[model samples]
Target: MRVFYAVVLLAAVLVLNFSLMHLAPGDVADTISQSMGGADQEILDKIRADYGLDKPFLVQLGHYIGRVLQFDLGHSFFFNQPVTQLILQRLPATLLLVISAQILALVLGVVLGVYSARKPNSIANYFVTFFSLFGYSAPVFWTGILLLIAFSLKIPWFPVAGMRDVTISGGFWIQFWDVARHLVLPMITLSSIFIALYSRLSRATMMETLGADYIRTAKAKGLSNRQVIYKHALKNSLSPVITQAGIQFSAMMSGAVLVEAVFSWPGLGTLAFQSIIARDTPTILGILFFSALVVIVGNLLTDLALRLVDPRVGGRK
Candidate 1:
């Protein structure tokens, strides 16, 4: 049933995206003409005919849907490549940054939240409170710029842009470390806000769970503090955090655009940015479609994870 719903939803998304892009002002021919300084009506008309822009909206949409059904996302107007191929080439970098940031946020958020809940009025709790407030309040781009200045310019701890060092030549581990180093600043920049969010949520849930009847019973049964907290309370508190993580995955993808542009990371975000500037509707739509698919898959995995964490979730469903 879930899979069926996902298919239906994806189709709806495809139609809506296609309609919106069609309605938007200008087309690939306009962008191409502008890039060429100017063009006569004949050249513009030829360009439109070549790209099938002359087709009626419904006809174009039908053709697009047919191509998509065959796993063909169409060609890029600017890159002169298959949309799917371009996306595939850039996907790993985007996935690496987004997933790494998510993991970093979840781990640090859960740990800080648990500790803060355990020591509510302590200095560490206060510190966590301050960090969360700032992280949550700051704009993602602004935070990214700050990190760039402090780490890249002032102290020179990390590279200013790009994913890997072209100058460095070494074995696999050495190359891997170079990439990892480049990843650190962007990952931190992207994860900062999410870490703030998760930490606060975990703290609230953990605090509530600690006061629950089960927790009291566990303590009464002579369970150690670690056993009670880790084994009893923490498990129950994770569902909401996981739910938030799943919901925010799409937002992270969008946010990655700003982060990617700031750091010049060669990801879909950068590709999407370039496509938009070029009015490359096919490439833009392809990115949006792929992003939607990723978000849907992330939500499904979140459901699966929840079912594992608490089988009662599946039972209730």
Candidate 2:
């Protein structure tokens, strides 16, 4: 039943995306023509016809939907490469950034949250709360620039832009190190907001769980502090954290456009931004669908994880 709903939602998203793109004032051919010094009407019409833009909306949408089902996203107007190829080339870098940011956020946020919950109303809790607010409120691009200036320019600890140094060449380890070096600034920028949100959410969830009857019963049973927190409170606290993290993951994947453009990370967000400026419909649609898939998959995985963590949830539905 869940799988069925997922399919229906994805289909609706695809249709909405196709209709909106088609309804836009100008087609890809018009965009291409204007960029190329204003081609004659005949030439523009030919380009449109070649790209199937001349077809009626339903027919074009039908062809597009059929092709997508077959794993074909069609050609790119600007890059002169398959849309799939362009996406694949950029996907790894984006994934690396997103994954790194997520890991940092989860680990640090969970720890801080747990600590804050344990030490509620103490100075440490207050400090964590204060810092979280700053992290959450700061703008991503501004944060990136500040990090660039302080770390990259002032401290000279990291490079300002690009994924690698021009001097480095060959070997997997060397390439990995280079990518890591460039990733630091962007990852930190991307992670700050998520870390703040996660910390708050975790702290809240943990505090509530700590006050639960099971936790008090465990305490009465003379369980060690660590066991009470870890085995009793923490496990129950995870459902909400997992739910928030799943939703945040999807948002980060789609919402990193500004950070990607600011940092020039060559991720899907950057690609989508460029495609929009160029009015590259295939690339834009590709990104939208890819992002939707990520969100859906992330949510599904979260649900599964939640069920495993607490079988009661699985039995409920």
Candidate 3:
């Protein structure tokens, strides 16, 4: 089954990731020892033994994989907290930002794409195509910086960095609004590329759908333009868009690392970045496996959406 294949592939990727992390030049014990101001050899060896770093590579890996299967990601050397606890705390903020951006991209992308398809050779279509390329090609961190300068510093409309104002503390609603206020810049930064991509994809899909015989027949039978486009063409065109959206969502979740770091947003990406720097293998592996799970689940959801949109796809080999 497709699900079984996906799970097997994900498991392989996780194993490879674990091996590569171990094979990296420095051991976690060495990193910890160095950070602790040149501890004595005996003490360093004790610390290594305490954390199982003194074990053979295969033994360490086996224990790690076993613990992971048991949902025990172990404690973070840097944070002194369980990796799952840390990730769960930060995941919502990242999800809020990315999911909102995705919605914006889908709505704007579909609308602009449909309009461009309706007038393929028109100036509006040309302009949309040109701008989409520019948006897609832009660097996310650079874009975040520009938005920070333009809106946060220059215009003074939003916070320059961090997830929320440190001073605001009252109730859930107050906290939520504060977080939302700071989220605008990073959301826009993340959404820009997706918007461009969705627009281009939607335009292509719509264009193809418009050229289909069914669309022409519907138009010839005297259906209104809106009805023909919406009721018929849009429905069929959505399959591809749904697929792209799923993939894009997965990419955004992983790729938000740079954007989160730039904006100082507390999210899995930032957490993962810090973990990598600190050589916190538990946190790093936790994030890697979590991200893979998200991508797989997203793809599954996309398949379900496709089936709902067009049942023929569900029935096909």
Candidate 4:
């Protein structure tokens, strides 16, 4: 049943994405002509026909859906490359940003949450609460720009942009840290909101867990305060946090566009930005297709993960 829904949803997404691409202003042929210093009408018409832009919208969409089922994403008009190849090339950089941010956010948020929950009245608790509110509420682009100025410009700790230094030559590990160093700022910007959200959620859920009847029973059995938290409360509190993490993963992917543009990071988001400016319909639709598919699949996996973490969700299974 779930598989059926997933297939139907992806089909609907394909249709809508194709229709909306046509609705966007300026076709690729026009951009091409303008780049050619206002090329003659005959050239423009030939370009359109060559790219199947002259076809009826329904016919084009039908052909597109067929190609998608065959796992072909078409070519990029602007980049002159296969869509799959381009996406594959940029995918690793984006994955590094996304994965790093998730891990950092999860670790920092959970740690801060646990400490705050254990020391409700301490200065550290107040500071964490204040930081979370600020982190979550601020605009991501704004936060990214501020960090770029303070850390990249003034402090000069990390490079301003790009996945790695083209000049850096060494063995694999040396190249690896170069990219990691460049990633630090973007990762922090990408994860700040999630970290803030997770911290507050963990605190709230932990408080409830600590007050539960089972917690009291454990304490009555002579379990220490530390054991009550580590053995009993922490695991249950993490169920909601894990679910939230999955949901945030989708949002973070979409939001990476702004960060990528700001820092000139070479990722899918950067590709999307450049494609839009060039009026590259195929590339734009490709990105939309990927984003929609990822969100749906991510949500499904989140459900499965939540079920594993909390057996109440799985029930008989």
Best by lDDT: 1
TM-score attained by model 4: 0.95
Instruction: Name the candidate that leads on TM-score.
Output: 1
Where does candidate 1 stray beyond 4 Å?
none
Candidate 3 residue-wise lDDT, 64-169, digit = tens: 8788888887888889999889888988877787788888888888998999999999999999999799889999999999999999888999998888898889
Q: Candidate 2 — which pairs collide? A: none
> TM-scores, in order shown?
0.98, 0.94, 0.93, 0.95
Give lDDT tens digits, candidate 1, residues 73-161: 99998999999999999999999999999999999999999999999999999999999999999999899999999999999999999
* Collision count of model 2: 0
Residues 1-317, candidate 4: write the lDDT tens digits: 77689889989998998998888777999999998889888999999999999999889999999998987889999999978788878877877887788889988998899889989999999999999999989988999999999999999999998888999989999998999899999999989998999999998898888899999999999999889998899988999899899889888898788888878889989999999999988888888888777778877888888887787886565
Cα distance off (Å), candidate 3, residue 280: 1.1
Q: Who is ahead in lDDT, 2 or 3?
A: 2
Candidate 2 positional error at 293, Å: 1.3
Pairs of residues clashing in candidate 1 = none
Assess each prediction's global lDDT (C-alpha) against the native.
0.96, 0.88, 0.87, 0.89
